[model samples]
Target: MISIQRSQHSPIGLQLGPSSATLVQLAGSRQNRVVHAIAQEQFELDEKQSIEERDANIAAQIRQILSDHHFKGRHVISCLGSQELFIQNVRLPQLPVDEIAKVVAWEAEERLPYPLAEAELRHLPAGQVRQESNTKQEVILLACHTGILKRHLDLLEQAGLTAVAIDVEPSATLRCFHNSSNDVQTNATNCYLNFGDAATTVIFADQQNVLFLKYIMQGSNHLDHAVAENLDLPLKEAIRLRKIVTNSPTLDASDELHRSVIDSIRSILETISTEVENCLRYYKVTFRGKKLDQLIVTGNESSPWLIEFLSDRLSTECKMGNPFESLKCWPTSTSILERPGRWTTAMGLAMKEKSNS
Candidate 1:
């Protein structure tokens, strides 16, 4: 139900997340590319402001960001978090391409949480499934509440911008990895883990298409909160200490504070590992012969310790994902690389133009 209009100019990419909004503008062809600007603004909720007023304020902030960056055009492709959308994989009998949509709508009526009349549904044909006597097709179904979509559209309209298409975070994250410089093994299955402030999304895929997706409510913020509570430190200080411990080679056993920090971080890592293991187990059961080849972690929460911990626990090769690896940018774009993981969704949204072309 998302409409995408291809334009001559580069389309702006926006990711409105629970904690912040990230916007990226890219121009020129891929070979002569220039990453015009990448900006992120954290939201400060005011209890006194009504929902409308708060949205208007955020729109005002977005306008200022675009104006200061000298970005052109008001059209953008945005991404919604998995928490805001309903995604499911459905299997249906083989049918003509034209009939697929109609069948999917009927199926969605029963499966979607929202009323079919009040939801905008979209379907992507994943692939075909072969049975002993017949063939069926697998489809990825995405449904969003009409109110949620309208709210986003209204916010962008108030910001003097138009949203051309809205994408899910998991798909956008997959786009980042697919377009990265890393060599993807065609025959091997891979899992992409997007760790966000509110949730973590695990996407099972290969070089071509997504095989499965699972959302875990636990995220990097949970780890930060745990560290803060365990260490009896302020949130900011706990965040700093987490980074220090994660990046350090080893904790000082003689220091009680160091030992405590280590223990807290390990506990959170163990939780994350367990969740990932469960997903992997399901994947294995569903796709008997297939094996997960590697794991790619991305998002603002990804760190050295997280990767190392998951690698050891999952017994799989794990690495951090870099969204900027394939793009050429101006000198000012260096700042975008600092938190490359945070920009994956936005960067992937920006790549829609090229991908479609």
Candidate 2:
């Protein structure tokens, strides 16, 4: 069964992506916290491999990564990929807390693309709204395919890890931002962007709730591919060049090849910028009169160039999100400040509080 309980002891937060896995461990409470460990690994699966063979390979890689990091816990909290879950916000007539679930489930049946019986559903009451004479409640609904959830659980079990809770990725990313931001209690709206290997997630939220969310099927991998094709370099070389560009802001424009690579990167950023603008426009239409206060970018793929470009393109203050901003790191812990974007989901998963249930 999928569980949502919290861990009193240190629990590992493991994020399994299409091409990588990230793990983070934290100890102590929110008031006084320390990062225990953080580690990431990339793995490959051959297209010709059988399903069982692929799973075994992934489990093996995870086991090795855990051992390498010396991660201390067996209990873990994990997140479902964006493609594996369906999330939506709905409004329902205000009712007793006990009656909300039934109505939300009924609404899910009508809105969700899949049959309700094949999905596991969860809902959180966001807030109340006044509609006509009656009050209405806004709820965020999340549903995951039962089969996909089971496969993830089984994979973890096979890797000798016990999953204590399963959360959606977008929510996990939002949690990281909310916990780390100094202005989290403010009423200003904030937008968060998390760029993954093959996808990017956009989340618009305020001090109290999530206002909008969307997933775009474009990310750093596209940039890597573009660079590879333009520079006639292997994928690994393209990735290395991309990192060099991100790390060195002052590129010597004298080199034709270097300029070409930069141009390709800019083109990809333009595509991402357009999508972000679209999301912002949608939010404006849905929540009239409220404007985004800032845009925060995170994820392994986030870079200096992308952040600056997006800031100018959107005409909104843009900054990098640090998942460890609020937490202290152990003296021996690896440098989390180096690539904070990659750990947002894992850190957020580690910050989960005990459920009332």
Top TM-score hit: 2
lDDT per residue as tens, model 1, 99-125: 999999999999998799999888877
RMSD in Å for all candidates: 4.7, 4.6
lDDT of 2 at 59: 91
- On the 0 to 100 scale, the lDDT of residue 48 in model 2 is 92
Q: Against the unseen true structure, what C-alpha lDDT does each candidate score?
A: 0.77, 0.78
TM-score list, all predictions: 0.84, 0.86
State residue 240's C-alpha deviation in candidate 2, in Å.
3.0
Separately for all candidates shown, the number of backbone clashes (residues 3 or more apart, or on different chains) is: 0, 0
User: Ten consecutive residues with minimal summed lDDT in candidate 1?
Assistant: 330-339
Give the Å error, residue 97, model 2: 4.3
Instruction: Summarize candidate 2's per-residue lDDT along 66-85 as a digit string, tens digits.
Output: 89988886888998887777
